[model samples]
Target: MYTLILISTMTNLSEIRALVLPYYEDVALICAIITALPVLVGIILYLSKNHISKPSTPKDAEALVEYKKYFTEKELEKLEVPYVQRIENNIERDVIEEAADFLKSSEQVLIICGESGIGKTKLAIEISIKINESKELTGNFKFKGNCLFANLRHYKNPKDIEEKLNAKLSEKTVLIFDDYQYNMEVFNEIKNKALRRNSKLIITTRPIFVKALKEKIGEVSIRKIKLGRMDINGILKDLEDGDLKKVERISEGNPAIALLALDYIREDPDRNAKEVFQGIRTSKDFFDKIIKDFQKEYGEDFIEFLAEGELTGGVANIPQEYEKTMIEMEKSGHIAKHESKYHLTPDVLSEYLINREFFSGTILKHSFEELARADNGTYILEMLNSIMKIKDDREIYRKAAAKLLEIVDQLEPNAEQKKKRIKTGIMVYDGFGSLNLVTEKLKEFWTDYDILQDGKDLLDLGIFLIKISKPYEARKCLEKAEEIFSKNHDKVGISSTSHSLGIIYQQQGNYEEAVKKYNQSLEMKEELGDKSGIAITLYQLGNIHYSQGNYEEAVKKYNQSLEMNKKPGDKSGIAKTLHQLGMIHHDKGNYEEAVKKYNQSLEIKEELGDKSGIAITLHQLGNIHYSQGNYEEAVKKYNQSLKIKEELGDKSGIAKTLHQLDRIKKDMDRLKEKMGEENFEKAYQKIESNNK
Candidate 1:
């Protein structure tokens, strides 16, 4: 094409050359403009097309993203399960099954109740699924109805929840009325809707509310399936990867508590529920330990408040004394002290305590044959040794404690049962320290967490030991514990056990092992929607790195942990982790950083009156002063710590203060020697003046 153009140009030669040269420039410029036209047009079309076809975000997607910007997938999933996992084992199960049956029969308003976490919504889900499957099987071309689940907690109006459910129910004709525990108005509305639409209504609620409704509305036509003991097979299935004893021990014949048991045991098929019970018992005792410690600060008032039950229609504050007592207990952390009233954190904890005490032949509930050999009578005497120590118990408290102890002494503890018994014993003693005399009788089992013999028990008991400074023993206990959860079919248990093992490893010197265990724990936590647990593990992993002198690694771990912790309102744990981080900074000579950590810890301690923890920070501050050669200041801190230790009668704390005081003295002497008598006297005087 160039040659042809050149040839054409040459045709005009000679005289045409001058005309061609000027004309050629003009023609060439025109050609360049023409060539650029297609490219420019193509670029404009591409930009216009991009603008026209830009992706559009659906309203749901945008709203969902915005809602989730502050939450995690694990946290968001919580909104899906409206059931609290409470209620008696068989009662809850039967209710759910019956709810399904009634729904299948197109009965409207299947009422649900009998305590929190009763698997009400869970049963509703099951009922819905049953209906759905039956519809699919109906030889009908299409099932035009759909299933609806709505929680009353999220809505001020049951009508609104009904509206939402209706949108979905119209498609499947099955509606789940959850949180029916108190919202009778909403319950009746759903009942009416179910009747009108010829749809099924599976109502989940507490019997108190149901009774109230029955009384008010005059016995509405609905199936009254009381949720009680879960199906035994279902219990085992939930504990599929766990043990029978665990289902037995933690569950205590109630499927409700068994759900939490899934948070602890890593069951092996070779091991039955009885074996997993070992894990459950340990977790129960561990939690009891925490509660009892809080109880000590607040007194037994909280326990009673917690045990007193939360069903307002059934129970109310008796008088000024009980109310005051409840407030005190709440302050001490035994109860969630909201609005100056108390409720057990959840019904599950109460049931765990009650069932573990009375029904099943757990060590706590066992007949003490070994003691009876000496004299079962003497064992009751021994049990009273501790029961006599608790402050401000009404007759009911003493009677309850004594009876529970009598049961404990009479039973023969299998290794697993023995471990649980020992754990409960330790918890009792620890909770009511005035009962140290009783601890001596149970001394053989004091450190017998090891004797419990399960992977989860060993690991968790090991972590507990670390806090109390029984490192060598803790290490030994955790040593027997496995790294990964047993490849048991109980997937839920596996995750919890894995997390326990990770925590143990983290406490030990093996950081790599710790990380590995933590990762496994994290995976399990994620699968289970346990954000609080995950955050705690992450923080712990960071601490492991900090211990190994990896500050950056520690910070990263802490940040990750904090992010998760904040979502769950785990303030106490968050404060503690921040304290560790401050230490890392202080060790690195980052005084500001260190101060930040201690300050955060200090704030929480102040709010909590965590005297024992406050002692630790005061001690740290003294060290920080000593590091800067401020001997007088160090001594002042040491004195402050000593004062607290004295107030609390904390032997270990007293020892710490003594150590700090000795160091301060030595530093003062060295400073005196370095400056010489005359100048040092002047320097000491200056220090004294500044200190004043």
Candidate 2:
């Protein structure tokens, strides 16, 4: 058996050798082929690099032509202004820098998300300019390419855009799509092509569109850089200090709006910044397009609900049926959710919606009382102010203003609701600029309700009356409020009412009564430990002393008020005190000291956007120039003050300035009489030369 097994094993071994020996030549050949394969690939790659034709770069003129197709002449002009860099706090990264980094990476797509007018397109343009200039941004790759821009809406159809993109895009090329919306077929095709060609795409769109874009471009290497509103100080940094404050208030950190404001100023160089801002129609088309798109996607009722929510202090109460819709709206960036409540996003949108509702009469369908009782009544006032800006809508605004006041009489005066009624009435009068309507409403309210019972309401109305320069009406309200407060033993109400009365008396030139009211208010404020109230009373007392021609006493009171104001950082109070001090110095013939004080006050008022205060200070400066016989300088300052007063509709202030101008003319005539015509002409020339 062992012999047979050995013989079989040997036979098997012999068969295996016989099978392997014939293929030895073939095995050697396979090994040689494997060893040379890498060398063959290297040779092929080198030959391909040298032989293939490179993409032709367009000349600068041709590039400009292509860019013009995407940007308007006006938009191109805007590029002359350097782009302000925006930084992201969370990542501590410059948005432009991050975008450049993304362009250099393997990421094929970058979506820049922001609200309308938040500078997304401008940022994208800046990023494109950066990438086009810097070869380092492309890792110093040999395939230098152009940066192209297109707004998707500019094309007649998606197919047109797709064809253009396919024809233009190449390796290392950067393409920007401004105001991009997702089209699944077009985007998917372009995305695949971009990946294959090693190109990059940058998309600028409202935040609402980003989610849809992400979903449509599935598995594509994409990054997102969200933009927020520009910093308040960053927008138009070189604007005059007063104009800067106006722009900051009106733009609300929106860089596009800020730029629009700058354009308005350029167009009307002589207008007050406040007037220019009031007349600037924020891109109605942009806001209208957003609303239309939202309505189309979410239905009219849903859009209305969001708008109404915004009008009512930004808290939307979603029902069970609208829960999914609300979530989708939040995802689409039409609304934001906080603590289980949804709010319409981008306050400008809310303002637009309110305006739309006002025009459609949808807002008027709700009683003014009901609207006023909503979480924020200020929206109603803001809406009225917006309407008042439209020159053609004056009649309609007056009608609406009347209707608002009429509704105030209907409001019930329960504890919680009474406060709303008083606030609504004051806001309506303050914002609408209709004194007759307010006066009628006040008379009706006083007759219908027991004014003596609501001391706080009377006090509030009196203060608002004083602000509007209605001294007679303010005196009536304050006296009534003081009587009620005394009867009720409400020291805070008494103090506020006394302070308000002091303001009215001082305005009326009744210095003795003004001092008495101020003392009463000051004593009560001290007892109540109201530091801010005491500062205000001291300032008022200083005004009384100044009017009485007691400069020394006025300075003492003003210094006391100034010290108190500084401790609490009450800039407005400090500014008022400084202005009074300047007036005293001016009367004492201390021109230099007076100018210094007035300028300090003016700076603070400009920073605060206090047009009324600014006008007053400017008028005082004009007085100093007049006293110094600098006729040209005085007229310049007076006209500057007059322009602001006119813009503010301060009739009394305007009258005062016009009177000063008349006095300046008379003074010039008197000089002409004292000095003969030729001598007067020579003197005027000399003054002009000195001024130069």
What is candidate 1's lDDT per residue for 1-692, written digit by digit as tens?
A: 00000000000012223323655686576567658786576655565577533222111221101222322354336324434333342233244334335535533445555444445445555444544566442332333444433433334355445445565545544334433433446555655555565554444544434544455334346666655545444545443433554455446444545655565455444455544554554455333533444344335554444433332211245466567765544432234544544444333334333333323324332332333234323333333332332221122233345444445545576664466555555455443332333333444454666465556666566655655557677667655564333543445556655655566566566778878877877887788898898888888788788878888988898988888888987877788887888898899899877877897887676444465677788788888878887777776766767776775567787897788677665666897878899987886776555343
CA lDDT of every candidate: 0.52, 0.62
Instruction: Note each model's CA RMSD in angstroms.
Output: 32.9, 21.1
Q: Estimated TM-score per prediction? A: 0.40, 0.52
Put down candidate 2 lDDT per residue, 446-479, tens digits, no spaces. Answer: 3322333577777777787677666777778778
Runs off by more than 4 Å, candidate 2: 1-302, 312-316, 320-351, 354-357, 360-425, 432-452, 465-476, 504-516, 567-569, 647-649, 674-692
> After aligning candidate 1 to the native by TM-score, how far in Å is the CA of 485 from where it should be?
6.0
- Candidate 1 stretches with Cα past 4 Å from truth are 1-420, 428-441, 444-460, 468-488, 503-508, 642-656, 674-692
Clashing pairs in 2: none
